[model samples]
Structure formats: C-alpha cells, structure tokens
Target chain A: MPKLPKPPKPPSYSEVRGTVQDNVIWKSIFRPGSIYRKGYRDTSRDRALAAMNNVLYHLHPVKVKRHGLKLTYTYCLGGLSFFMFILLTITGIFLMFFYTPAAGAGAEIAYLNMRELSTTVTFGALVRNLHRWGAHAMVFLVFLHMARVFYHGAYKPPREFNWVVGVILLLLTLFLSFTGYLLPWDQLALWAVTVGTNIAGFSPVFGDQVSFVLLGGLEIGPETLLRWYVLHVLFVPFITVVFLAVHFWRIRKDGGISGPL
Target chain B: MSDEVQMDQEVYDRLIGEGKSERIARAKAKAAAVRKSKIEEGATLGPKPAEEATKALEEFRSSRSGGGGVATKTAAPADGGGGGRLTPEERAARVSASLGNGGDSGSVGVPAASDHTHRLLALVPPAGIQQVQSKQQDKVYTWPHLLLVEFVALLAAGSLLLVASFFLDAPLGSLANVNEVPAINKAPWYFMGLQELLAYFHPAVAGITIVGAAVLLLMSLPYVDKNPSAKPENRKFANMAFTFFLAFWGILTIIGSFIRGAGYEWVWPWVQGLGFVL
Candidate 1:
C-alpha cells in the first residue's frame, strides 16, 4: 500500500510562540507555573468557562505551586514503580505460554518449558528468568516508592484518596506476586504457600477459616492453584489497573505534580 | 553584549560542564539532521524508517526491560525489571548507547541536523547548569534544581524489585504438597522486607508496625511530597533525614539477608553501630 501525505495545518503565531516558550531549555531554569499565560485577557461572563477549560491551571489551585517534574524527589520513584510494572508484564506474558493452572502438572510443565527453552530454544530461558526476577523486583520497588512518598509528605489533604489507592495497589501487587507463586504447583510453592497462608491464619481470630475458604480445602493443592491462578490472572490485574487510573487521575485533580521539599 | 555572552558561556560551562552544552548542541543538531534525512528517504523508499525505527526501538526496549512482554512498562527498569547498581562504565555505556551511534557525514547522519530553528533559553541559565554538572563525581550533591540523582536511586530500587522477582520466580518447586519444605526458602522480595522485619521486631510489632508503616507511608505519599521545596537546598533536612533512614534500614536489611547463613549471631544495630540490629 502506498503512504498518503496529509496536509499540515496552518500554524497560528501565538501557538508557535507558545511551543517555543515551552521548550525544555526554557522550562528547566525558569521555575515552572510562573510566567505562564495567566489566562485569556477576556474574563467577564466567560471566567467560569475559562477556568473550567484550564485543566492545568484551575483543577488544583495555582497557589499549590511547585517545580516541574524533578527527577530525584517523587517522579523518579514513581517512574521506578512504573518501570518495574513494565518488566513484570513482559516476563509474565512469556511465562503464561509455558504455565498451566493445574496443581499436578503446573510445576512440572514450568520446569519442562524452561528446560526446553534452554536446550532447544536459545533466549527463551533468559526471558523466563527475567520475568521471574522482575516480579520479585516490583514488590521491592513498590515499597521503596512508598517510603519516598511518606518522607516527602505527598499523601496529605487533597491527595489522600490517591494515597489510599496506592496502599491498595501495593497490597494488590503483593497478592499478585503471591498468587503467581502457587501457579508453579511445585512442592516448594505448595509448602511456602501453605506456610504463607497459615501465617494469614494467624491474623486476628478467624484466620485459619479465612485461609481455608481461600484454599477450598485443608491443604495447598489443585484448588489452591486454581484460586491463585484466577487471582493473579484476573482479580489483581483488574483492581491494579483501575486503581492506577484513579491514582494518576487524582494527581491531575490535586495538581499536575507535587513540589520537591 | 560580549561581556554578557561570556557570563552566559561561563554559566553554561558550569551547569552542564565545559564540553557538555557544546556536546548537547552538537547532538541535537546531529539528531535533527538525521531525522530530516530519514523522512526524506522514507518518502522516496518503500517503507518509512521512522515507523521501523520506532518498532525497533520498542523491541530493543522491551527485551532490555525484561522477559515480560505484557507491555505498558517496558522502559521502567525498576518496575518492569531490576536495574539496580549500574557501574560507572556501565552507566557511561548506557548514556552512549542511548545517544545511539552517530551517523556518517550528511544531514541523514544525525537526528539534529535538519532542524531549522534554535534559540537560547534564559529559563535554564547556562551558568547554573555549568555549576551543577561540574560536580558530577562529587559525593556532596550540588544539584542544579533537577532531581537526577534522586530519580537514579529510585530507578535503582524499582529495577531491583523486578530483578528480585525474576530471581525468585516460582520459588517453590513443582509440588503442591503443603507438607514439603524447601531448604533455603525465602519469601518474595517485597514480603522479604516484611519477612526480614520479623527477625528484628516481635511478630506483633513486625506485623503491626513495620508492615503497617510501609502501607501507611505509601498511602500518604501524595501529601508528603506536596511541599514547595522542589529545590534540594529547600529539601536538605528531608533529604538528609531520609538518607539516614534509608542508610540505616537498607544496610541492616542487606546484612540480615546475606548474614542469614551465619545464623543471626552477627546482627548489629546501625544506630548504635553495634546492638540495634542484634
């Protein structure tokens, strides 16, 4: 198929100037949010409409001023959380091809798949290893990301809802990782989960009963694997994705990004 | 005018370093040129290199990101894959690699060449950048308003998490026999932070305090960093206190994990420099 050339829109002078003004070179040194267009000169009856249109300017007050996306403080840690998520998704997809949600064959299949990838296929093992490692890494990053947020005080007032959402995300992430462990259907996975759930059993008063409901029996077997598979594959992802959407949206609602201090 | 230019040049030299601005200018020019030429070539050729290049970059990025191909986070090393502890040479290699191999002579050679307009920006004064970039190797950070080092540390943490995940993938071998036990068993990394806390605090405290603290802190981040101290000097106390906490906790955890084999005998508190961890 041949490519079609589209006509370029005629440029507006002010728009062009704005683009030039917004360049990184200019933004870096100039404290952001300052020297910005205060708004259209026309106020009158259109003031409310104008303010509503100015998402960047009005949703959060201009008074909650801060620097742009400085890397060290919040953005970096946030970015780190994002990066780890990407890594997990990549490795996880590849693993799914080899993994089966059966307590009996799941672990055996995982081993076989990995072995085949190593012996027959060249880079397949690397991919699996990378995914496995990435999953573990996400948990650590999430916590550190939390630590950064705490020390920085980014969870106060207007951003409190998002902060709660973030905590849920962290729990969901741990749950996701835990569920994945059971899918391997190995002795270690079974027992670790058994011990892990048993610890859950220690929570409050009715812990053992709670774990039993989850496992669907007295032990970590096929039912447990199935439950874990469902949790990892369906439940956790759904919640995390929804929470993330809300979390990011809240940042916009509260303000673009917080200041560094 | 000449004196002002000299001052500006001096500032630039300080912020990005003497050769860096020139390097950036050259790099930008080279890139524009390369891109313009490629579009021109793509217009004449069968397939556009722009799309192909993007696809290729994405592929490379995904591979580098980790084994996961689930998309959405291929570039975030900490989130998608563990990239902690990049050596200096490794970092240099990464920087040069990111710049990509410069093209041969001509507009098509570098991406910056085809650009028609360039302007001097007073927003980020060259002098300040020069002052900051010059201190690249200095332990005492003199950040010129950009939080590069902090982000680097954050990225390190993120990457490590993913890497830790990879290492501990399917930690339990193939058997759902709740009765079995693996010899060198360990919890997943995130839980390890909690699990490790078990050794330090009583179960009640570990369960309620450390775990609770982490959860509470994460929930409170948006408010925590909402202060107007985007600038480091404005952030000295927060930064130092955080650094101290991180140092104490991080070092203690590392020792706890590695020295686990030594059987909890050598534990030491970093605060007292001796007994706290014990």
Candidate 2:
C-alpha cells in the first residue's frame, strides 16, 4: 500500500553454484576439465582431461582396456589391497595417538592404552578393529592379486621386472603386518611375534644377530616393543610406500592392466 | 685458375654442351663435385629420389587409411608442370589451392621457394621413422567408467570393514608375560603356513630354505617360465606349477589356523574351539 521497494529475487541453485564455481578459489582448486569445474560437459575431451588433471592419473590412465572393467577380470583385488593399506594407515595413526609404545614388567603403558582404547576412547576400539581386520584383508588381497597376475601370465617380457617389483611389495606387506602384530603389547602380540621371529632366528648364518637386531635384545622385551613400534609405524611403511610407488608405476609403464586373457 | 676451381670438369663440360649459362653450369658442376666427394667418403645421402620418397609416403598413407588406394596425389606432373619455373607468388597460390585453402588470401604467407630448393612432396616413411605397432584397443574413459567402478569398490570394501568393525572387537590378550607362555602359540594367519612347515621340517630348513626358495621361485617365475603366451592352454606347465604352489600354501595356512591347538598339536577346530584370533 505504501509503494515499498520490491525484494530482490533469490538466486536459483544452479545460479548460486555457478557463482561459487566461477570464483578464483574454486577455479584454482578445480582446474579446467575437472568434472567439478563449472560448465563441465560429458565429452571425451573433458573426461580425458579430468583424469589427466587429477592426482589419480598417477594410478590410472585416461582410458583403460574395455575388458578390464569386467569385475571377473581383476576382481578389483589390487585396488582393494591399496585401499586397505590406506585404511590401515588412517586407523593405525588414530590408534597411535591414544596408545604408547612403552612396555615392561612395571610399565605396561602400551597394554594399558589398548585397554583404555576399548573402554575409554570413542571409536578407538572400532578403529583398532578396523585396523586389525583391514591388515589381515590387505595381506589376503595382496596374495590374491599375485595369484591373479600369475594365472594371467601377466609377467612375461616387459612385465617381468614389474612382477619382481610386485614380489618385493608382497614381502614388504607381510613384514609390515608382522611388525604391526607386535604393537598391541599383549600375550597374543608377544607370542605371535615370538613364533614368527623364532623362524627368522633359524636363518642359516647371522641368525643370532638377526634375532638380536629384530627383538632388540635376547627376547621380546620392552626394547623389542619400542623397536617394533618404530618399524611398524615408520621404517616398514616407508619401504612399503617406495616399493608400492614402483609397483604402481610399473603397472602403467608395462602397458596398463595386463590383458583380456 | 680454372683447374683449381672445385667443380666437376665432366659435369661442367656436359652442361656447357647442353648450352647452359656459365654461372648455372659452374654452380651445378660444383654441387655435383661435392656430392661425388661425399659419396666417395661414404656419407649417406639425406633425401631420397622424389619417386622413391613418394612411393614410401603412399605406402604409409595407404596403411593409415586402412590399406586402400593412395589418397590425393602431392607430386607435380613430370612433363607438364615445371615446379622449378613457378614464381614464389604462383607457388604460394598453388600450395594454398592444393591445401583446399583456395582463394583464401587471409592464409599465412608461404616461404618463397629458393633456386636450389625442391618442394617437399613426400613424407618420411612412418616405419623408418618410428615402428610403433600399437593395435587399437577397445577402451573406455577412466572417469565415469573406471573411476566409478573403483569408487564403488572402495565403498564396498569400506562398508564391509566398517560393519565388521562395528560387530567384532580386535583381540587383546593379557599383558605379555615373559614368565608364562600360551600353549597354542601361533604366528599371524599369513605366516601360519611357515609355522606349520616348522613342525615338519627342521627350523633352518623350514624358516630359511623353504621360505627363501618359495620367494626366490615366485620372483623368478616370469624369467624361469619362458612361455611367451598368456593363454592358459598355451602355458599349462606354468599355470599348473603356480596353482600347485598356491594350493600347497593355502592348505598349510588353513591347517595351521584351524587344525592346531595346545602344544601346537593338530586338533579339530570344532572339538578344541578356535585357537586363532585376528
């Protein structure tokens, strides 16, 4: 009645989204050809550019053999193994924050922390469980992946070196799992590691030296726990990552995802 | 002074006999002398004859176009079209017309042809340059195709793990007692196979020899099996050997994990209850 100024029309969802995507920050984050970029179309050029521009390009090519998309071809074992490794790393890091590596007769901080994880901490027990199960799954998946590669005879010619690298990666995965097995600082952890390391101690020569270095003493003591914690969290993972990089790089270089056979 | 000039006397005399100008004859003779000297020195000639080059280019073009007849001809007619006689402007117009840019004066200026320069009508043979024999593969874009599959796989694995984690708890036995030991002390399930081997073989043999041999054999598989074919039927022996190894290890792991009890003795898992924990 008083001839008041009309309110501005609200922006549509797409309009607001367009404005957000048009900004410098958004453009910087999602480069041209990114699926997330503004005005992205489902074109061959954009699809290829998306893969090329993303960090995933390191692991995947812009196009893959059509046969590789078949679930039966790969069972996605290799990718799952890598994903499991990443999951374990995340959960392991979470566990590491609440737990201590120290262990002895009077000082069993590691064990106490584990108990606290179950009883006191939120999602700690779940993360621990995930880490444990994910580790076991990774070992299994890596074994399956090796078998898949072998059965396909994907190890011939230019792939032979990659297969060797894969073998190294498998061994490293096992070592990572073994080192981590000792971190819970419980009877299961201690005895399991004892049985495993006892096998290592039976190596032809340098047996005692190997055992000593591995256990950090005559037996699985406080020193052994600390040594294994460092190995599990730092040393073995570092080595595994380096080998994993080579393994993945070789997969792409050796002509991407083996064969239709 | 004429004897000291680096010109082929025979070529000079021949061109002179053909009634060529003194400057043109001398220049042609000098080039012929240089070419002869290079040939004598075993220096390979750079460009092949136009006919040979055209043949190679035609072969390459035919192969690229699915092995049909030669595409459009680039070579000028031998008798009628005097490529050498054309002025620079005329040459530019001819090139533009041949390139299907006819009457487009806006096209970039073509480089003027020099007196000695020949028009490049033939391409280097693709085979001679680079023999990349990549067969066309049936492929799909990785974004929606491969990345989608990968994302789904990751989600499936993550959800499975999450559900398992939610229902089950990770085992945590009593504080590690150096004094007392568990009766059924076992390694993790993966190493359980090796531990099972320990019961049968001597420690050194089981731990070092068998394990080392297995790893060495696995690593050397590609090199050892000289079978180039990936077909299962073609590589029967390799497939059989690897299958045997897998079955052997798998059986051992199963036995170690489920069939072992106190004192690491064989016991039915159903009877003794599982002596294993994840």
Candidate 3:
C-alpha cells in the first residue's frame, strides 16, 4: 500500500499575529510610536510617544501634574460633562433615525414617531432613556464643574477667559436640552417648552418679536418643531463644539491643571 | 574707512618687544589707532571702577534700610572696604589670591590695563535672556497615568448610565393638544427655580432680568473678584455668597419640582404624588 500522506501543519497563533502586525496595512493604521504597534514596550520613551503620536494629543499633553491624578481634586466633573455630551449625541443620533419633526393641523408625525419609537423599535426605549437622563446629567455636571472651578479659584489670572468660555458652554448645554425637550411632542414636552419660551417672551423690548421668532408664528406649530429640531441636532451643537475646542485648548495654554490648594 | 586706519607705532613697538607675532602686533596697533580716534570723537570705553560700584551698593543698602525696607547684603570684595585705588596688576593678584591660585605663577593671564584694543564681539542686553521663574513640578506621563484614570472614569460613567437606561423608561404623555392645558404646567427641572420665582415677582423680572443678571454676574466673576489668591482662606466672602446663591436656587427648585401641585400651589410629594417629569 502507498504511504499515507502527512496532514499539513497549521501556523501557530503567535506566527499569525506577528504576520498580521507586520503587514503594511497594520503599520499604516498604527503610527510609528503607537503602543498598539508590534514592538511597543513600557518604557519612558514609548509612554511619551504613545500620547504624542495619538489623536488624543489635542486634548491631553504628554505629561500631567501628579496631583491632578487625585480623584477629589477635580472630581473629574469637566471630563464627565464632556463624556455625557458625547453619550447624548450618540443616543440622540439613534433617536433621530426613527423620529419625524412634523406636527400641527391634521398631521402628527412627530407624536406618532415618538409612540412607535418607544414601542416598536429595538432598544429604542432604552436609548431614549439614556438620552434624556444623560442630558440632565450633563447639565448638572456642567454646573458642578463651574462650582468646582469657583471653589478652587481656578478661574484666576490666565484662566479667567476660559471661565467665560465655560459659562457660554453651559448656556449652550441648557439650550440644547430645552430644544430637545420639545421634540417628543407630548403634553409634557409642549407645555414645558411653552412655559420655558414664555420666559424668552418676557425680554423687555423685543418680547413680542422674540416670541414670534421662537414659535415660528404666534405659538408652537410644525414650523417651530422643525426650527428647534435643527437647533438641537445641528446649530447649537456645532457652536458648542467650537467653544469646547477653545476651552480645552485654553486649559493647556494656561499651564495645565491648577493647584494643590 | 580701511584707507583711513593708521597703525600706532608706539603700540606696534611695545607688542613686538613683548614677543607678539608681526600679524597680531600690526592688527592690534591699527585697532588701537581706531579706538584712539573714536575716543577723541567722544566714544566712552569700559565699565565703571570697582570702588564706584561698591559705593553705589552701600548707598542703595542704606537708603532701603532707612525707608524700612529689608536690607539685602551682597558679597562685596574683601579688599574693597579700604576704599583705596589699586593698579590693574594688584587687583588681578587679589582676585587670583581669593580664588586660591595666588601670585604670578597662576595669574590667569590678566591683560595689561592699556590693552583696550581687544575686540568687542557683541553687546547682549539683559532682557535678551530668558528668566525661568517656576521651579520643577512633580509630574507623570499621561499615557498610562492620566489616560488610564480617564478611561476608568469613562467606563464608570458609561456603565452607570447604561444601568439606568436599562432599568428606567423615559416618560411619554398623551399627544400635544394646543386646546388642552394641564392643571399643573411647569418648566423642566433646571428652570424650575425661575418658575418658582414667578410666584413672587413679575414675569419680566423673574424670567428675563434676574436670569440675565445672574448669567452676566457668573461670566464676569473672575474680573469682578480682584482677589489674587487661590487659597480658600483668602476668599471667604466669595465662597459664602456663592454658597448662599446655590442654596437659594436649590430650595426653589425643590419646591417647584416636588412640593408644588395643581395651580402651582404647595403640597407635599408624599400626598400629591410627583407632578414633575424629567
């Protein structure tokens, strides 16, 4: 009988991993100093290079004051506020897929969309819950962050301008939340917004004009819904992001984190 | 300018006698002639004498002390106390002796007083140099240190939000009807404090003026409080005022959200059920 053919041997895990890591495509994906690269080690040079070569370099410096690492010092309020904003954006996008900004007269597409979103779509209710709660959390966090900065007196000297930027960001956050509140088109959303916008109508000289501009007519309607939807998803967020960039840039320019005191 | 330069015969002869090369001696003699002409045209040369510097320092110290200022003592020359003039060679010998080199054997190549022909390469102003006022601070790399903490914070917040989302469902009331108005209409919780203010003040005052003024004050806090200190002990009033504002707002918000019922009147949440929504 002829000798049985030997079964071919498979490549080892390490060999396959090595081949994948050494490929041109992988090398392009991870820059020269990336810790994800094949030869990375926990050396001082590699650690610095990891931060320097990454996209996060824009937000973080290569090194930070050691005291900033302490949880109580910052309570991580500002970072968490930013994280909540990101969370809300993601969840807001998911909701936008199922939502329609139409309302008024015979058509109530916006209200219909809200009902179907909570009932029919997969994970819709969960995402909506996260968006709502995260928005509230973000507003609360931003306020707490301001308070933290005040108590620490981190708003002194070179940081004073950044504090003003921060206040603007806080106002933007509130506007974002208020606009989103009206999107649900429920009694709670409509009347809450009516009460909120009525305050804008009280602005001394331009009261009537501002109210008309906000409502798109004399009161809440399909036009108002569309206008606010754009503000919530696009206009306000765009402005907030611009200010966020400046705020983070100033933090680095003004000598990193504040004091041990 | 080159044609006008004339070599000083006396300087050339002295340099030659001191064993300098012909090229160096000739260059030095020409430079000396140029310097002499410049001096004749009113150019100043060299620094003030050590005695003058010592006298100025003494006078400054005395004036500062007389004005109740802290007197700063600098290291004045050991032999400068006599206030007597010394030749360049004697001064060089004293400097060398102070440095533990001493006498002619280790004289450090002091040039003669008349050697004013030495080239002036450049004059750098004091302001041209950088002054480092801050000392070294304790720091750590951001990659594993700060980024790791941030990652953990992100995970914690994300997980908490996820758990909340899983357990709780967002509220959805009946469709909006312009014809129907609810008995207890209120703003979102964040604006509840302002809404609560509506009970006591006019809408314009409670809503627009007060809110606007609060925001303006918050934005201008840094400029307003001119205190330079970051320490809490130095800013008691600022802290107290802010804390009071927070407490006032907090109380109003709580009253508006939980303790108020139909017609915006007060009622305990335990009895009326929560009239608020997120």
Docking class of 1: incorrect
The CA lDDT of each predicted structure is: 0.56, 0.87, 0.88
Rank order by lDDT, top first? 3, 2, 1
lDDT of 3 by residue, A159-204 (tens): 9999999999999999999999999999999999999888899899
Give the TM-score of each candidate: 0.49, 0.76, 0.76
Candidate 2 or 1, higher TM-score: 2
Worst 10 residues of 2 chain B by lDDT: B107-116
lDDT of 2 by residue, B1-278 (tens): 55565999899999999999999999899989888999999998987677665565445434533532324343554453333243354455456655655434442443333242444554567667866779999999999999899899999999999999899988999988978889989999998899899989998999999999999998988889887889999988888878889999999999999999999998999898998887
Error of 2 at A93 (Å): 1.2
Q: Which candidate do you rate higher for DockQ, 1 or 3?
A: 3
Best by DockQ: 3
Each model's fnat? Answer: 0.37, 0.94, 0.89
Best by lDDT: 3
Clash list (residue pairs), candidate 3: none
Report how closely model 3 matches the true complex, as a DockQ value.
0.67
List ranges where model 1 is wrong by over 4 Å.
A1-66, A105-111, A117-122, B1-179, B196-256, B262-278
